[model samples]
Structures are given as C-alpha cells and as structure tokens.
Target: MAESDAWILTTGLNNGVSKLVGEGISQYRLLRRHPKDVVCIGLTMWGTINEKTRIDLKKASQIGASDEACKRQIRDDVQEDKETLDPHHTHCILFDSGNLNEYLSDSQRSSFVQYVCDDKNSHACKEVFFDNMNFQQRLIEL
Candidate 1:
C-alpha cells in the first residue's frame, strides 16, 4: 500500500495491542524516514474509568479537595478530559459511551468501521482479525 494511504486506528492508547501498533508504526516511520506518511489514530470511549481516574486525580490536586469531594465536583463539572494523544499516535477520536470496552452500539460500530474501511486515502487493503482463541494462531500465520 502507498504509505500516504495508510492509517493505523486503535481501540485505545492504554492497551497492549495498541502499544504494539504504535511501536510498529514508529519503527516504520523511522526506517522509511517518512514521518507524515501514515496516520495513527486512537479511538477511546468518553468517560471511561481509566480516563475518569486520571481526570479525577488531576482535578483533586488542582482544587485541593478530598477524593470524595472531588468525585462530586467532577460529576458537576462534567467536562471531558483534554485529549492526551499517545506519543506514537498522530491523532485521536473520542466517542460517547458509558464504560470501558463495552460493546459499541450498532450505529457507533458501523460508523467506526466505515471510517476505517472507507477512508478517502486508502486504496488496496490488508486486515488481520484476532480473537482470544485464535490471536496467536493468526499472528503466527501472518
């Protein structure tokens, strides 16, 4: 595939697979000396527990409040955390969801998949699907 037509989209920055993908992309860029050829995007659920925890800690420290009080304030504040794009990623997209890694609703899943598959720049394609049982097998085969 042409480098400019490539994109690496991940579930989140905090996962093992996502980290590996980031490292792979970084290595690719280094070897090719093409820093902007591909896009690395991290897609994370809004208000996920991990995200909330980080925001809570920051808010608590900033306002000098107890944890319980901070939690209350966070509820009232209701603003989403500022984007902290992973070092390896070039961009990020956040979606609204109740919790972490919850099955995305049909519409949301469709939209996300469409974004990946029909990206304007992509022409030819390659995909690897992995699951708990077959992930190792698939990787070995690849």
Candidate 2:
C-alpha cells in the first residue's frame, strides 16, 4: 500500500495482530522513501484503551482543553484486554460507547469500515480484510 500511497487501516489497538501491522508499517517507512508515505490508521473503541489513556483523552476532550494537553502513553494497562495506541500508527480513531468495559462488536467494526470504504474520500481503493495470523503465516505472505 505504501508503494501506491493507499490507506492501511486496522482495528485500532496496540495488541496482537494489529501491533505487528503497526511494526511492519514502521519498518517499511524506515527502509524506503521513494514511493510515498504510508497512512496507517487505527480505529477502535475508546473503552478498550488503557485506563490512563482513557483518562487523559477524556480530560483533553473537555470544552476548554487544548489539544496539546493530551499525551498518550505507549504502554499496556495492567488490566487484561486493555490496550494503548500503537506508537507506529499514523492516526487513531477511538469510538466511545459510554461504558468502560464495552467495546465495538465485530459487526459494528465491519459497518464502520464499510461506511468509510463507501465514502468518496476514502484513502484506500479497496478494502483489505486482516485476520490473526501466526508468525510463519505473516512472514510467508510478505
């Protein structure tokens, strides 16, 4: 996608498969600059992020808060299933469902992705589905 300047979107979370995707994109950027810069975007539920990140984000969202006031830590929360944003990702979109433990369901994520893909201003020309892949499977695909 970098070669064509396409958008590389993933379920936004600095965990598991998504983490690997972020790392791969980071390495790709470091290795070459000829084709174009890759726009790797992550979209995930706000409640899924670590407690610290969530608190910071909420504070920054206050009416009078400055954008500069927010700073995300790149560490996982102590709580299981909580995650932080990947440092390597170019952008992140966090959807808030108002509950701390609630996250976007697979159906919701799919609908959101489809909505973006159908938009005229979408970054990628096509939708790329990603699944959890073992180390060997991912390496072989490359």
Among these predictions, the greatest lDDT belongs to: 2
Q: On residues 7-83, what C-alpha lDDT tens digit does candidate 1 reach at each position?
A: 55565455467767777777878887545566667666554434555455457467765565455424545665433
Candidate 2 to truth, TM: 0.68
Q: List the candidates' TM-scores in order.
A: 0.49, 0.68
Query: Residue 57 error for model 1, in Å?
Result: 13
lDDT for each residue of candidate 2 in 25-120, tens digit (9 for 90 to 100): 888777885536777778778778877777676685796545544554344544355788888888888878776667667676567656765676
Candidate that would win on TM-score? 2
Give residue 31's error in model 1 in angstroms.
3.0
